[model samples]
Structure formats: structure tokens, C-alpha cells
Target: MVLPTLDKPVGQCLTNLRRPGGLGKDPERAQRRAEQLAAVDPDWNPGALGWTVDWQRHYTGLTLLLEGGAGLEEIVPGVTHRGDDIGRWLARQRRDWARLNTEQQHRLGEMGVKPVARPQKTATRTNTKTGATKGSDAFTRGVAALQQYIAREGTTVVSRSHVERLPDGTEHRTGVWAANQRARRDKLDAAQLSMLAALGLEWAA
Candidate 1:
């Protein structure tokens, strides 16, 4: 906890942004929960601020991911400068809105953009060019896994779970993976079991 300052009243409660107690849970997880609820709620509007590709004349726009915030965000799809957002994503791409021809539409679609509407349950989170994401099979099968672990345990310097150890006593994850999820999963599974048999990947070893 940070120390109380002189300007702040003594004994008054202060909201800690770091811990998320007063700020509420992280928006990503909260959004996932809200969608899960909507799936079960009969009264929920099918158009109830769920994820959609907002076409504001198309040419100079970006995809918006409307999720949890002060209000519904999924209405936008991907975040773009012209659209409304609670705040910009921590990570972002730089685009030149001026470079785009707002009035015209491409017949064969641009490099990183898709024309079809996105669906919820299997909404693909990817990098259009590389098809990559935070935990893409190539990046880390372990991002959400690690984040979920963090949400439960809070802050700590050391961590456990799914850490792979190679020879030479170096403990770390090392490998590339197939582009397909099914193939990637099978590879990871086999690798992990083999590592276990070889006396690596053991939590206590």
C-alpha cells in the first residue's frame, strides 16, 4: 500500500488502483463474465452492446472491441480514433486515418481487415497479418493462464505452474508451435509429458 499523504485526510479511505479492490475487477475478465451471463439470460437483447464491427462509413475506421467499461463497448468491435472508447488499449497499432479512402470500399479486402461480422462464442482474437495474439500458440499458451493465476494470488515476485525447465538447470519456456490450435495443443501435451519423464517440468524438482 502507498503511504498516505499530508494533503489527504488522515484515516480516510483511499482507492487503490493497483489492487483493483475499489476500482473493480479488470475489464477483460469482467467482460468475459458479462458475455457468459448474456448467453443464459433470456431477456438480454441480442443487440445488447455485444461485439460488432461498427461501420462508420468504413474507409478510415478500425475494429472495435466493445467490452466492459463505464458503458457497453462491444458496440464498436475494434478501437479506432474516431469511435468512442472508455480509454485506449494499453497496446495499440498506429494507423494513418488520412491514408485511407473513407468513401471507397475494397472489393478484395485489405491486408489486415476482414469484412464478415464477428460472432461471440468463438470470437477470434488475432493479428490480421501474423494471426498472433497475447497468448497465441506461438507467443504464450500461458498468458491467460498466468493472468488467471495472478488474479487469484495477487502480487508476488516468484511464480509457479507450467514453467518448463530445460537442461543445464535453466528454468524457462522454450519452443515454437504449429499454426493450428489442435496441432499446437497436441504438441504441447506431448512435449510436457516428455519433459516430465526426463525430470524436467517438475514443480518441486
Candidate 2:
């Protein structure tokens, strides 16, 4: 029998299978169906593995890349497989290691995944000569505007025509700024990409 693809409907079906009611309220058939799925892939039930299906899917992709002769270094951000960004997922797993449970940590550790050092926060400084803040480059100012917008709106979905006003009497066309950054994303350094990702930009991730 062919296994069903784990799309939304199938995913919901799997979730329902784990409930007390079982599939279609038929204990015997549900048991047989569950057994068949288990025979195909033991970790079919994500709850049993103590993680979400999305997490398991990304982990499987990472393992597949390794099995296909890709090294850890080659798994840096932008590596995509089966439409999932394995590199970004791996980076997030390492950067947020403390958020994972011991089981998840052990699984990742077995695959040579380790935590990354937290980036140091730079203190904002004022220019003595101009009386304005230093490091207010275009990118930096755009990121600051995006950060402020997120803090106020609780989302990164800025309208293309939205303008953000800063507390320092500066106004930023944040929506346009973000669009420009994404358009020339290839020129952005890793640090710039990380800042955009931190602001919840999906493309940067």
C-alpha cells in the first residue's frame, strides 16, 4: 500500500489516529492501520517522538543531506531540499538549543549539531561632532524602523506604502525599505540577513 503524503488532510488524519476515539471509531481497523504506518516509518507519530511533525520533517531533511555526503559546513543558510530551507532550520536549531528538550538535544547532538555562540549586542553611540547617532547607515536605520514597527504592530507584515515614524523625529518608509532590501538580498552580508530574520522576515530566513 502506498503511504499517504503528509499534507494538511493527512496530517490531521494522523493526529486523529492518536486520539482516544481512534480512526472511524473502529479500534481493530485503527490498530491495523497504525501498525501498517509504523511498518513504513516508525516515527510516523510525531507526538511519540516528543516533537512536532514540522520539526521532524526538517530533522529528516538534515539527516538526508548528511547521508548524501553533505558536511555540516555545507549546511549553512540557503541550502534547500524538498522545498524546505534545511540550512536555516539547522541554524535555528543550533541558535535556540536551550529551548529544546533533552531528547531533542540528544538527537541533534548525535547528528553533530551544536549550539552557536550568541551574538554580542553593540551599544548605540552618538557622534560627538554631529550630535547624531553613529552607525545609522541605511540598512541600520531600516532595521531600526522595522524593529519599531514590529514592536508596535506585533507583526512584520508592513504595507508597501506604510511609513514608520521613529521617536527621534526621523521617519522611515519601512515597507519600501524592506522591499528594497529583499530585492538586493544577494548583496547583504550574513549579519544583515540575520538582522532581517530576527525581525521575522521569511525571505531572509
Q: Judging by lDDT against the true structure, name the best candidate.
A: 2
CA-lDDT, candidates in order: 0.30, 0.76
- The residue pairs found clashing in candidate 1 are 63-78, 64-77, 64-78, 64-79, 65-77, 65-78, 66-73, 66-74
Best by TM-score: 2
Candidate 1 lDDT by residue in tens digits, 1-205? 3344645542232212223433356777756655664576532221122111121212222333222232322324344445432122211111112222332124113423333343455555445535534224533433223323233223212233335343345444322121132234444453333322111122211
Q: What TM-score does prediction 2 earn?
A: 0.50
- For model 1 the TM-score comes to 0.19
| TM-score per candidate, chains pooled | 0.19, 0.50
Model 1: CA > 4 A from native: 1-86, 89-135, 138-140, 156-205
The residue-level lDDT of candidate 1 at 118 comes to 30
Q: Which residues of candidate 2, in runs, are more than 4 Å off? A: 1-20, 24-36, 119-205
Candidate 1 residue-wise lDDT at 191: 32
**Model 2 lDDT tens row, 95-200:** 7676566988999899888999887867555455344334337778898788766644445678889999988997899999988889999988876787676555
